[model samples]
Every structure is written in structure tokens, then in C-alpha cells.
Target: MRDTMKPCQHTLSDDVVYKDVVVVGNGPSGMVTSFVLAGNVPYLKDIPEDLPIDEMLRARLSNLPPGQSLYDADLLELAEGLEGRSQNPISLLMDNLLRPCADLGIQADSLIEWRYDVEKEIDHVVLGRGPPGGAWHTFPPQVRTLSPGAWLSLPPHTTDSAERLTASAVAEYCRRYVQACHLQRYFRCNVVVTSVTAAPPGTGAPCSPACPRSASYCVSGYDHKEGRGFRYACRRVVIAAGACDRPNVLPEHISHHALHQLAALEKAAQLNQQHPKSQSRCWWWVRGVSAADAVRLARASGLHVYHLHRTAADSLAKLPLLNYPDYNQVYKMMCDGASGNYTNYKSLPEHMIVEVTPLLSPQTTNTEEENKIRLKKVKLLNLVTNKTVELTVYIVAVLIGSKPDLFFLQTNFDLNTIEIKKCKCNEKKIDEKQCFLRNHWHYLKSVLGQSIQSCKSRYLNYTEINGNIDTKCALPDCNKRDTCTCNTKAERGLAVRECKCEIIPYSNLRREKNCQCQPTNPYSSGLGYGIDPKKPVDGRSNPVAIDKSTHEMFNFPGMYALGPLTADNFIRFIPGGALALVTHIHREMKSE
Candidate 1:
């Protein structure tokens, strides 16, 4: 069929060729959509002049593979070939093709760049300027697939026996999949979609008389090769732009002053290096900071910090500890240097400026003396205890977590329809005083309160320990208590005069047979302490709402989305979602 049909001349040129579909991404989702549409629909082989494009594209979609059972023997074969070899099936194929040369000690990496030239075979164009792998190409080399290698596989291609895959492998696999399936011919690489606007009235090819002036959509973008803008009018548009394409910015509520203060503290710390013996003391008040950011900033500043909220546990786990060596070092530093003491600060001074009161005359005080005197103490009120503790430190660093990166969505779409709202933790209205704190502090405080209550209950139970009961001894000063007895007879005689109970470490006491009270895991919660119990921590937020049946934008007809854009960013869910979306588009186009 491909050999018999001549390629559209307009597509070859810079001129606009009205297509049945124009997929606006080259990611897994975009590639799958193009493949499914081209492979299934036979009318794409020859667009009838009299028939409407949508109707022509959708015709006989039923004859194609069933949506639910799209995976078949051909796909299985591809999977088998790809299994246990390489993440990039194309790379694997190339390796196989060049194996004879490799046996003669030829270097494949030196022979060619690991990229395939895609042919523009299908009527529909898959537009992306990025590497054939899309967002996967930008992923860190050390990053591994959250889902198994098989889950990362696109349709008609499988990862085979491989259980896991790295980011590079996934990228290569995508490139290879495109080449192997001959889907590359459909791709228009090096074209970035700038905007998707409604087709201008009374322009382009007419699909029907009822909407003679209207085309469903016109995708306009810059072509890097041509160094000029290009537009394509299409009956359907699929937006497979991954979630991370546009970086999310921190929320407006976050205090710039606090960040400036942190920067100043960092500068001050750097200056204190000259006097190693008299190192300035730094205390990080981790109230609003995300666990990930806290660790990062703390490591950068060389400051001792602590997480005061259990909510940070989830964010902490999402940090790429394994992929980035710095994260591992920071994790170790946080564990060793900082205390994970969750404390509530209530009814405190809003902003107390503590500057060292100069004792010596201005003329007598030298620069070194002035620097020493500049380090002063700050008072913090403990909400639980209602006591003000003066912490003698040069600077206090406050870490507040970052907000979702929905800048692109907010700018492009309606926020209300998309359901972009303040975080669940950001319940209270921000005030001038509270602006310095994190939005999620209240939520973290509540979790801390629960932990504290649990700890108190354990402490109370320990104090009530009896001789008959297998109780953890809660005697605060067991050494001070002369009434304590030991199990050994040798220490029994000394029990009346001195406390004979062996002093076991607090952590070890939990598992000790004689210890009555067991301490709870300090970081225990739904997400666990210091790690993301959930695989993808950023789920449920910054979602691009889509109709499940069609995977289309609820408000925008002819516009579809998938992958992280639709709240299903995991590797496992992307392929299925891509399939369903394409199927829906096919059915919808067919109905037209």
C-alpha cells in the first residue's frame, strides 16, 4: 500500500497540507497515537476527494484491532526480540545488524550516532523537535524506570525478559520502536508547536458545507531546520506534551525575604571559614520547606537542619538519592547533623530582629571583634510547651517546599476547569506574618501533633510498669532511683544502695526483652519517614483533566492529551493511556 501511494507533495514542501490528525508531541504517547491511527485505518492509504477527512480517517476502524485487545502476536514477537538485550530496540537491532563488524572489533558508537532517520509515510504528522525519544532523552542517565522495562514498551514492541530499564535505555527503545514499526516516516522532527488555534474561517480545505469556514484546529509552530514558522491545519490535534516540559515555579505565597535571608546566611557561613575554631552556629528551622529542598539547601549551606513535619516524608523519598550522588551525601549529612524533632511554635514574636548589642566603643571595636559580636541568639516559642527557647546561632534557615509547576497550563487553559487549586495543605489564608512560613506547615504540624501524642501515650504507659507486667521502664532518672533491682543476683545486694538496672541504649531498649516500652518509628506515617513510600510522589497534583473515554480535553474538542499531562505519568500507565486515547480519537473521527 505504501509503495503504490505517492507522498503528498505539500507535506514535502513548506506548504500546509490538511491532515486527518496532527499529533503535537513525539513522546511515547504521540508516537503511539500516530502508529495506531496509521496502522489501523485503511482510508489513510488514499484520501477520497469527495469524502470528509474525519470520516475517511475513521472509516473501518472496527476492522482494526480491538481497543481492549490491541496487543497481538506481532507485538509479542517485537517484545521477544527486545527482551534482555537493550532498552532501545533500535539499538538492539543495530547491534544485531553490526554484530559481524563488532566481532571484527569495530566500535558501533564510533560507526554512527544512535539515531534513525524517520520517513514521512503516514498522512498525519507527529511533530516534535526533541530527540526521537522525547522527554525520556532529557532524563538523567542514572534514572531508572519506575515501572518494569515491559511497562515502558510501546505497542507492537516489548522489552521482553528485561525487568528494569534506565532512562537512556528507554529513550533508545523509543527511538528504535519508531524505526522498527516504520512510524518514523510519520514523524516531522525538529518542529516545535508554539500554538494550536482554531482554523480561520473560509480558509484551507473544506471538510463539509455546514462548517465550510471552520477547520477543527490549526497547529502553528517553528521549524528549526527552515528557521521559519510553519502551520498545519488538521481535523484532530493530540497534545502529548509531557508534564515536565515546562518547569513548575514556586508559589507566590513563598516569602522572598526568607529566601534572601537563607542566601545571606550561606554567605555568612562561607565568610566564617577564616576562624575555624570559632565556627558560627547555624540552626535550620524546617517549617515550610519541602523535604527535598531542605536537604538540598542544607547541604549547599553546610548547615544542620531537621524536618519538623511528617508530611515531608513523602517529598523526601522522591529525591533522586541513587541517581545523584550529591543527594546521597546530603541524606547522610541530614541524618547525622540534623535532629528530626517536630515542634510547634505558637504565639511567638512575629519577627524578632536579634542584633548583637555592641559592648565596646565603636572606635575601639576591630573588624574581627565586630564579626564575633554580630552572632546573636534568637527566641523561638514552643507551641507544645509554651516556653521560649533562646537558640544561640548566627543564622536560622527556614525551608518551605515548592508549589506545582502548572505555569503552562495556567497560562493556556482555564484554571477552574482544570481544577488547579491551592494545595490541600494550604487551607488557611496567607497573612503578612505567616507569609514567611510554608503553606503546608499547618498540615505538617497536625501530623507532628499525632506523633507527639503517640509518644506521650508510650511514655505514660512506661511509667506505670509493674513487676508482673512486661513493661518498658520509663524511669527518667533510673540511676537516681535506688529502688530499682537487677535480675542478676550479683547486683541484687547493690540494688538498695544504687540503681542496678543496666543502661541499654534508647534505640536498643525497644527490642530488649526487659524493656517495657517500645519507641515508635520516628518517621512513620502513610508515606513513611525519610522516603517516598509511594513510587511517584508528584501524582494527584497539576493534573491535565481529560475525559477517560476519549482522553480528550473536556472543554476543547479535537484536542486530546495523555501521559503526565493527564495525571497518569507512571511508565506502566502511559502505553495503555496512549492506546485508549488513539482509539477514542479514531472512533470520534470515524463518527464524524
Candidate 2:
């Protein structure tokens, strides 16, 4: 007799408010956005038929100046032509909810404070440190107006509004706490982070020192009134907080490799000249391939070679290339980039890893016969044992690294040895499991590292990243760390350990995880290897989540205003036949 399982227990609706707009970040963008939207809101429709009489009364009452009253204010409304709309229709009904509420009162004051310090420096020195005669603002502190002079001068996306989504359980002392007391009077609400780890350029922080909206904000945790923080809702949330608004930093050891890659990129860029998007045609995708393979591929006609993790995919995603990285379409051999002779981030055996050397060439350019051939790897020195270890070069290389979660090793274990686990494609000949583990592990450390398993487990956060792997993933449950599902045994010849939550190998990544603390993978959702990896995960659901799938801003309307259009990006970037190819591919996919 089969036992019946219980019915699905439904949950209650959270106390969460369905905001008309819940802007994630509270940086210059969020704040000024809220201010412009709320305080000086423009009317949605033209003049609202009722305005003429109101204007007339105000004009009659104010003989001296129509500007003195509300009617004198310039009417604000949607421009005659709003831009950046897609084929799919979206809501004409968006609720006007104010994000980053008024806890930012001192935010205005701190900006004023910082500005005063600079202006007074030269004058104070001229006076020999004597008390200044007057202050910078021509009027008294009480005079609040959006006139020629005001605190709302900074552009959005640059300064910190200081208010942010405080994840539950983890109290945020960085901004909210700073905004609490006397500190607000002296300092800005949210502090901006200026380093690569915190806020990178094109983020909340501008690279230029003299950027109109340049300033650092604070980031840290503190005690709250106990509980009460982030509430997980069914709808979507955003993460456009600020540059200083990052989750965590990578460990010092892992981060240096990215810096090395950046240095190489700089040199490469210099060698190719600034307009090298053309000559820099070598599409090197370093994932789980060997150095021999890398050299082989690099020497090939089209593609270049590099290692995963070392390439810095996620971090660089925040840069200009994410918009249209010509590298994406180049034949990419997807693999984890880990020198797994001995380390973590190893890909499993059962998972499909197609091996073949990939073809690479100047993207979007017609290739000549001379530019289309593959290369083979030559024997390389095995320094560890001084033996020759040969590696083969194949199409598109991927780095394979391992990230062993205690969550896995802790819960499901019956092992005493450092055994390599593998899935049997057939289980007829090769000792794939033991062979793989023995080839790429430090038995001593795996055993030794278990000394500290007593630490309390907080929560888990697995943010699903984007395909480009440039920007940070949206926080899953901000308060929690990342906890992934790891299967203990290989059931039916399939290794259950392999999942997106596992190690993410990328040609480039600013970071794979956020919190460096153990027992939890900080940025666990692993860098988005490609667009919505879930499509690869689940059989159903389209990979591309049409605009309606998300509540966040898709693209900027005035992108054309920022930079001049180049033929490479504006038109030629797409492979000549990609559009037709994409259509055909989509049709095939739908049929399948």
C-alpha cells in the first residue's frame, strides 16, 4: 500500500507592501529620482483642463510676481515622446510610490556640510584661521528652495541617498545607523564605497575624482531594535542602490587573479590601440581547459585563451562592454576555469561537457580561409612531479574549479576518505570518480579543514545572476547567506552535486561569492554563466524572460546622449547573419 503525503500547506501573505515602485538603491539616482518624482512632480496629462482658472486666480492674487505662488511653477509632465519602448506592451498603470523615504533628512545636511568644508578651507587659511565673516550659502539655513543654488545639484547614480533595503536578521549600521543620531548632523546619510570591492565605476561611484556626484558612503552591520528587516515578497525587487552598495568582497587570495587579468587587458588594449574592439578579435574563453589546451587554442586561427575565475567576468560586466560585449557570440567553449590538478570547483562527470576546440575570429567580420583553423597543444612541463603532462586543445575551453560546501559535506556523509565522486556515463571501464578526485585534491586538507564545524548556521542567499556576469545578482533573501542543495550519493549514475549553486567558472568575474565567511557561499547564486541559467536547469520556461518577467528597468532611454555612436557598436556588432539565425534558432527551439 502506498502512503499518502500531506497536502501543500499554504502560507499567509506577508506584511510586505506592494509598492508602486520600490527602488532598490538609495544612491543619488534613487534619491533625486524620488525627489523629482514626488516633491516636484510633473502632471501626467496636459494642463488638466482645471489649471487655467487656478493660474488666473494665482496671477490675480500675486500682482508683484506670479512666481510667488504655486500656480507660477512650471508644469511638469511626461515628454511628448518617451523613448525605449519594446514591442510588448507594459503597464500604463504604474503606482507612484516613493522609494527611500524621508529618513534622509540629514542626507541634505551632510552634503551641505561636506560642501562647506571645502569652500571654507581657502578662506579660513586666508584669514589665518580666524572665524569666517559669513557662510557659503547666501541665505539662512531655513531658506529651502529649488533656486539657482541648492543641495540637489548632484546627478543620480553618483551620490548615496543612504536609505536601503535592510535585510532581515542582518542589521545594517552602515547607512541607517549613520542616519540615526548626531552622525547625520555631521555626515551624509549613506557612505559611498570607493574601491573595486565596494562600488566600481558606472555604479554608484564615478571613476573620475572630479565627477559631479563623487563621494564615498559607509557600509557595515549594527544592532537594530532586534528583529524587523527585509520582507520577501512574491513580486520582484531591484538592486540599483549605489556603487557603495555591494554585498561583500572576495577573499584577498582569489581577487589578485582578476587584477592580473585586468593588467593584461590594459596591456592588450594599449597594444591594439583604443579602438581595438576590432583588432582584439582573439576570443579567448578560459574555463576548465588545461594550460596546454589554452596555448593550443590561443595559437589557433581565431580564438585566444585564458582561465576561468581569472578573467573577471562579473566585475567587468559592470563596465561598458556588458551592453554589447562582442565576445559573447564568439564560439565559447563553456567550462569551469580551475586548474583542478589540485583545487576546488571541479565539474562533475555526468554533466554534459562537449569537448572540441572552438573557432574564434573577429566577431561580425567575414573570415578568410587563412583565419579558420584549429591548433593542437604541445607537451608541457609538470613542475610538481617533474613529469610531462600532456593536454589536448579543443573547441572553446572552460575552466573547471570546485567549491565544496560544508552544507554538502556536513549533512550527507558516510565517507572517511577524500574520494573523488563521478557519474557514470556507462560505468563500464574508467574509474572516473576515484581518478578525478585523486587527480585534483589535497586529502590532508579536506580532512584537516573539518576541525571547525561548530559555528552557527545563519541563513542562505543565492542570487540568480545575469548572463553577462557583470553586475551583482539581485539578492535572493538579503538577510540570508547562500545555502544550496547538494545530493550526497550519485543516484542512478547521476551526480547530484552539480548545480548552478555550485562553483561557477567564468572567463571573467569580479567575484563569485559575496561574504567570505565560511559555512556559506556569500554570493552563492554563482555568477550568471549565461542568460537565465535556469533554462538550462529546468526543461520548461524560456531562457529569455521577456520584459514582463521583471519589474526592473531594462534599458536607458537616453543612452544615445552619453556617447557617440560607432559603427561597430550601433550596427556592425551583431554577426551579419545572426538576426536570421536567431529567428531560425528560436523557431527550432519552439518546435522542440
Candidate 3:
């Protein structure tokens, strides 16, 4: 019955806008994606002398016709055949093409040059919350990027220097890049994407210019500047929206004085203006050794910061002192408390913030300044020592971590949900029911065609990975009916259980139910190793499962993920994901 279902013939509404592509961010990744989709193509130039690029890969590029583009070639065939450390070969190839030998300090000139081709340009729109820079403009004034200014450039526009840049400088640079690349027309600022779902099957009537034969997605959102809602029907949706909008907050209910790390420094500055030269007390809750900008700015704002973090001293000691001088200097200050060059700072390592209580002191005057100093008693628990201490502060800054707000994606659709109609048979006899269901699963697989069989036949071997035995499946999702389990390993005395389900093939529709099972496996969607990209674990090296050649999410055609969501965290490597997406998209458009 599932195989007999026909495609829907619903027509699009007149209010829907049509485009070849819709990019969901305006950050560096989104900017790069837009730059390429806007018709800027990269071609190989004269290979530089004495760079650290791979020899075989360089030979391949050198062999290309001088005017021909590396992008025009089969990037999958070129990149996949070569050996590399990265699981994604195309990402590695693009990175090498953009910045060869960057880590080794050579900073070699880019091997490719971009040229705009009118024929290759596709109709697209960029939706973002702010002007071209995205969230960078919202950072604290004193905040500086972890990457050097030169590393943050979108192609064809380079920064003046390689020095570490301030937040405003980077934000302004990003803004100027849009103008420099002539991409201002394609960007829609102050727009919040509220929902993204598969467009109804037969929405072809209202398509503008021309209708697309490929899969189309519906993107609806609110426009803050226009004070109205907008919708778009696009052939592809690129999720370059980075993972910094929503902060990972503390468990406690936030009080009036508490602020996120990004806004805390600005609030501190405002307090400084209200009470000049006053020694304001602050309690800073941070995780790991990052967040140097907020910590430094908090001290510079005439606030005595009681720094609480979960990082071990040994971790700080392992940092390369020369490369990370700012962080190392912070560690040095931690070592040298209340002494030369570092004052009004205290480091409490291995401590967890237990509770926060707002205290009302005796009011001497009814001034705004008097109310601002209402104390917050922060209770701390030392993880190593199990000792508790309480301290009073004027304000609290929670600077732990952050993730992208992907609620729009979740609300509109379930990424991993698959529809599987329950099999009806007598279930009183357990053994007979198991036999009947197993046979029913085979019947479903047969209906799914040879494509499903080809996928499952390749990876039937049990292999050991990092001391744990699991199925070695190349595809994230497979039709294997095997129950994967491990109990009482001799070496570790640990039990591991990974439930693998027999997935039934059907039309890729959103908001469907999975097979009747206990605790459905997150990996059933074909995402990376069971990692949910929408709400990824903080600091975990979890990349979404994407086609190495195209950067498209597995099982979800016409959808791509870029930037930190793709697990390419550093700005220097993010553009690689953008390049992969554009190459695939451009090829698809050309084929059509």
C-alpha cells in the first residue's frame, strides 16, 4: 500500500516567493555560500612554489587547463581518491585549495581565483537576523575573535593584516564583504527563519521566472524590519546559520543581574559609567579555558571577577604558550593572583556554581545606582575538594557555552522520523510473531527495490572501533535487522548497547512516525554516528552525516549544512563546507 501512494498535486500560494537557493545565515559560511551561488566560480591559477599542499593533489590541479576551474572538474573523484586525516575529503580539498600550509605558518597564497559567470549565476536569497556579519555584530565591544583577522575573510576579499581582530573589526569586515562581493541585493537582513519544511509535492503553478524540477523546500519566517511574515520556495536550503545564538545557561533560574557572556561585558561597562572608579564585584561562571575575551574585559571594566571554571590546571599547562599567548597569559594571571600586571582577579579551578541568591541590602538612598548594587550571593562547590564557599557579587556572568537555535527546523519536521505501518498478525505466541514480523520486514525490503539491498550488502562485517565492537556500516542508516549489543567486556567490565532497527523505505516526508520500537535509535536518520546536529553536545567532535562529495545531509536531498553545524568549528576551515555545497548545487543546476 505504501508503494502505491502517488505524489501530491498541491499548488503553491501566490504569497510564496521562488528561488533556486535560500541560504539561512549571513556569517562567513553563508557569505561564502552566497558568493558562489551568486555565480563566482573558482579556477586554478599558477601553482605557488614551495608551499605545503599535498604533492599528488597539487599535481592534479597543475594538470588542469590553465583557464579551467577545479570546481568544474569532478571534485568528488579528485578528492576522494587521495588520502587525508579528515573523514570528509572534499572539505579537506577545499581547505587546501583556499589556504595551503596555513597551520604551518607559511600562509601560502590561495591556489584558485574566482570569476563571476552570468550563465552560472542562480537566483538565490540570504536570510539572516542582522546585516551581513550575522551574530558577530552583537558581541561585546572589547571581544576579540579566536582566529586572526586574516583567517576570517570570504574569498576575493582579504583582511589588511593577520593580527587578532576585535569583534567590531571582524563584524565590519563581514559587512563590507557583502558590498565588496556585490551580494547586498541577495541578502535579507533582520529576518528570522521560523520554519523550514518540504514543500508540498505539486507546487508548480506560482513559481516565478521558472519552476524547478528538483526537490523544493518551503522556508517561512518573520521579518522584523518589515513587520511581516515571508515565505520562499527554493530548490535548496543551506543551513550556514552558526551555533552561537543560544547560550548554554546554568541550571538555576536567572535573576535580573545575570547575563550571558556576550552581553555581560556591555552590562559591566554600563555599570562602570553609572559608578565611575567603583570596585564592582562579579562572579563569572565559565567552562574550559576559552572565554578569555569576557574575562579580560570584566577585569578591565573595574570589576573584581571571581572566576569559576571546570578546567584542570594540567589542561592549561599543556597549551602551546607561544601560539596561545593571550590564553597562556590568562593562565599566568591565574598562577599569579593579586600581583604585578594582574590584579582584581581570582581563579577558582575545578569549582561548580551551586546556587545563587539575590540579597537586598539596607537602602540608604533611592537612586538608580543604589538599586544596581543589589548583591548576589553565589555558592560554589569545589569538585576536587568537595568544599563549599559562598561569595557576594554585584553581578553574575554565565559564560559557559552556546549552540545554534535550530528550533525552526525541529518544529516543522522530524529529521529522523520514518513512517512504518505496523504489521497486523496474531501476537499471543511470541516465537511465531517474531517469525511473522521478520518475514514481513523482508517483504517490505523487496518492495523497496535493489537500492536498499545494495546498501545493506556492503557493510555486514562486525569490526572493532576504539576498543568497542560495532557494525562497520559506511552509510549511517541501513536495512540490517541485526540487534547490536555488548555485555561484560573482560578488559573494562562495561556494557554497551546500541539498538539498530530495520528501516522501511518510503517517500522522504517530514513529521512521520518510526517503527514500533523501544527507544528508537537516533542514528536511524543516517546522520553522523547517532549525533543529532540540531542539538549537538557541547565541545563534542560530532559532525552531521553528509555526502563527502556534496556536503548534503544523507537521506535529505537538496539540504546542506555548513559552518560549526558541520563540525568545522574554526573559521579558517568553514569556507570549505560552503565550497562543497556550492559545487554540488551548481552541478545539479547545470544538469537540469
Candidate 4:
């Protein structure tokens, strides 16, 4: 028993390594914190005497010249050629650092020991499997930052140009920053942190005599590639795993029996395809679906699509109409398809789906079987008609939109820690939900108005300046003051067409008399889009609340949360927030 105990103790001691800080995520917040600590923090800049030399030597060689060595030069040349075409951050960093080295004649062989000491500056560990740039890695190629390019600059690293950057470019920039600073060795990618607990009282003591404060946490995680569990004893832990790490799937108030009928309809469609002469018909009732997806679905199903939208005009102007050729095709398709079956509702429906208050027959009880039977022929209330119309719908596709991934927070943290409660009625009579809805409706109205304004400007330019008038605008002479009048007049030897343009008043579209929710700051308000009701009113909720000044968790000492994990969701704010936290951490360490 004594021999076995000794072996277990030895194994446990060998498994755990001590560090000054442990960042639990590899996203923007974690990467920036790690970068700052490694590069700027004075106390953490201690190089251990027994630090690994081989890893440092390899890192330095990748960023230095081969000098007169043929073998090294060839290897470096090959690496540079491959790296030029590579999007990998490390590769880009190596290229950036090494390009100047060859011209300067800085040899790799002579800098082995010097690089080793430089690599050992910071004693921190970043644990996560996410790409080096964190959530930016998952961003679509065309996804642009809300702020201008200059606002996204991290300390000691600036963007290539002072223009708005796409997600891919921003992510690459983050990678380059990491590589340029030589902070790659500190990252433990593919490491998933399972649990973080307070270290045992005595075990919390500093691993090194020089460390002012004792270690506070024992972080345990599993490595994907290694297929083994690892542990770390660290003085501080930063939780920057990101708020959207988990998906927030709200509770479905409706029963599954209604949704199941959709599947039955799909099966019937498949079987109908086998028999062409069948009189059976399948129609799609699309509501709140994107124009692109709706067209694709309609084309694929070959069904008469009834597109119900809450707008006066059918326009793809508000949608994400980027420069992609496929998107352009989709826009054209949507415009052509709208004339066939699009119903632009002046006002939103009271309820998308109406429940059958009582069973169809008096004999039927509210049983599951009876409910399914009743739901088959449910009544849909028409907001315009103020009447209920009964229909036998084979399937219903509900595509509202997506919410933040908050599943991780839900499973790990308590409800109050992450749950955002619905707004309460106050004496001021402000309906929070209604306020959000009105703001969104107004924003959409503004976008539509802008589109119409652009069209009017082009029409004026063609008629007055170019002397070319649209055939649609060429009409018989009418009174100049008439609202429906369209007449062509000569101006400076050019044909000038005068037409009364009728545009929907933005005020009429907005329901709320007064909108208290105005954008005081672009950084805090986010994009003018309406906030999802399922999300916290403030935005995404973090698992741990932290001090704004220190970025340290309120409940747990030496623990911090940053980036999207906090209130700020924009990329522009991340660098500044991270810098503050890093600065606070350094100050605390220095004081101790």
C-alpha cells in the first residue's frame, strides 16, 4: 500500500504544471490577453533556466536567414514559397519576419540560445481547440467588421489598410499578430477544458518563490490529438470561451404532433414524384424565409410558393446583397418571382400560427390523438381580413432566424448567471418587446426608403442630363401639379421628364409613436437590426459577471471574462477591453 501510494503521488506531481495564467479560450479575448501578458507584462517575463531549447530553436530558424548554408537555404526557400500561398497565421508570420532577415543577413544558427531566452518570456497557457483567431475563424469570408479597419487594430499590430476588413482578413491578422510576437509556443490548441476548480488550500501556494500570489485554480482538460487528460495549476484563469460557444435552442411551446405532419407531407411528395398523373397537389406556405432560400426551395419543390412578407414592396435591398455572382442571380430571381405570388402585408400578423381553442367536434377530448386530428385542419387568422380561414396544410416551414449559441453556458452555469429575463412593465409605459419590434420595423423602412431614393436619382440623371426617358414614364400630357402626372419637357436642349413619385411614408410604417431606444453609441447599439427576444436585452449574456475595470469575475478571485463573454459584442471593442484587462493583471501582479 505504501509503495502504491508513493507511485500515485509521483505521477500526480509529474502531471501538473504551474503557470502564472491560464486562458480557457483561444478566441479574440484569450489571444489578446495571452499576447499582452507575454509581450508587455513585466512579472510574467521570467525565463526559466531549464526551458526547452529545441522548440525555441525551431521557431527562430523559421523566422531567420540560412546565411551560407545550402541545405538550410533550400528548406527556407521551399517554406517561403509554400507560405506565400498559405492562409495559415503562423506561415504568414514566418514569411513577414523572415523576409527582412535574408536581406539583413541575420543567421539562424547563431541565434539558437538567444531565441530560447526570448521564447521563455511569459509563463501562461491558452487552452482551446478553436483556430488561433477564435470565433473569427468561423466567420464567413465576406462578413465585414462593423467598425472601420483602423478601429480593429490590436496593440503593436495594425491592419494592412485603413478600410473595413472581412472576417477572413481579421482572423488572418490575429494569426499574424500571434506569429510576429512568437507567442505560438504558449498555445495548447485542441485542448478542451472540462472543469475548473479551486486548488486545495496548501496546493494553492506559489509554485515558484518569486511568485507573489499563490495559485488559485486547478484546471483540468482533455487534449483531442493526444487523447489524454492534462492538468494545470495556475495563479489566474481567464474565461474567454465566447458567449456564442453554445447554441440557445429555446423551448418549443407548440406540440411536436403538428411538426410531424410536415414530415408526412414530404413523404407524400416523394411518393407523388413516382406517379405523374396523380391529381394531388402540394403548395408551400413560406413566411419569414429569406428571398434566396425561398426561391431555391420553390425551384426545387416545383410547387406554387405563397410568400408572405410584412412590407409594402417586394425588394431584396435590405438583404445581404453582396458582390457574389450567385447572390446577384438570386436577387434577379426574387424580383421575377415576386410578381407571381408574393403577398406584401402592410402590417405584421398578430400570430403566425393560431391554435384551435376547442376540438373540431364536441365529442373529442383534449387528448394527444384528438389534438393531432384537430391540428390537421387548423384555422389561420388573417390579420388583414380579421377572419379565421381553415386549411389543411401538409407542411409548415418555420424559418425565423438564428440565435446565439449559449448551450455551454446553460449546461455549466446557473440560470440567473446566463438567463436574461423578460422586461417588466414600468410606470413610464415603455414596452421593451414592442420597442425592439418598432426599432427593427423602422430600420427596414429606412433601408427601403434609401433604395427608392437611389432609383429616383438614377431616373433623374437619365431623363434630365442624358436626354433619355424611360418608356414607362412617357405618358400623355397632364397637369404639372397632378400627383399621377408624367410629362417630358425640354430643358437646355435635353429632354427633361417630370414625374410625381409616390413613396410610402416611413412614419406610417412605424407603429410606435415614440422610439426611446436610439443609438447613442454605435459600439453599444450594434447593427441597427432588432435584438432577438430570446437573447438578453443588453445582448449576449456571459456566464460570469466581472469588474469592468479589472475584467475579473466578481464571485471568484483571480478569474476573468472578456470579449463576447462580456457585454461588448463588437470586434472593435475587443482590443481595447483586452488591453485594459491585461493592464489590470500586470498592475495587480506588480503590486503583489
Go through the candidates in order and give the C-alpha RMSD of each one to the true structure: 23.3, 23.6, 14.1, 22.7
Give all TM-scores, in the order shown: 0.45, 0.23, 0.72, 0.45
RMSD of 2: 23.6
Candidate numbers sorted by lDDT from highest down: 3, 4, 1, 2
Q: In model 1, what is the error at residue 8, expressed in angstroms?
A: 11
- TM match of model 3 to true structure: 0.72
List ranges where model 2 is wrong by over 4 Å: 1-34, 45-238, 241-264, 271-592
lDDT of 1 by residue, 330-372 (tens): 3443343224332211112222322222222343545532343
Superior by lDDT: candidate 1 or candidate 4: 4
Model 2 lDDT at residue 278:
28
Q: Which residue runs of candidate 3 sit more than 4 Å off their true CA positions?
A: 1-12, 80-87, 203-215, 254-257, 312-320, 335-342, 361-373, 411-540
lDDT, candidate 2, 289-382, per-residue tens: 1222233324332333433233324322332334323222121212232323312122221122122322343334533222222233323333
**Cα error, candidate 2, residue 330 (Å):** 9.2
> Can you rank all candidates by TM-score, best first?
3, 4, 1, 2
Error of 3 at 110 (Å): 1.7
Q: For candidate 4, lDDT tens digit of each residue in 1-592?
A: 1111111221126777877788888877777777666754221112234433234434544454433221123222323333222222222322233221322222211111112223223468898776687767764445455445644655444433435667789889878877887779888888766556666565344333234235577777668898886878777777777644322211233333332223233443444356553223323332332333433443455544333333322333443444233434544434454343333211222323564233344334455433333313435566666777664433333333222222111111222222111211111233556457545865754644322222232332211111111222222222222234333433321223333443222343332222111111111111111132212322342223556556666556777766665655555445434544555655565455
Clash totals in order: 17, 57, 0, 5
Query: What residue pairs are clashing in model 4?
Result: 27-134, 246-405, 246-406, 246-407, 247-405
The best candidate in terms of TM-score:
3
Looking at candidate 2, the ten consecutive residues that score lowest on lDDT are 121-130
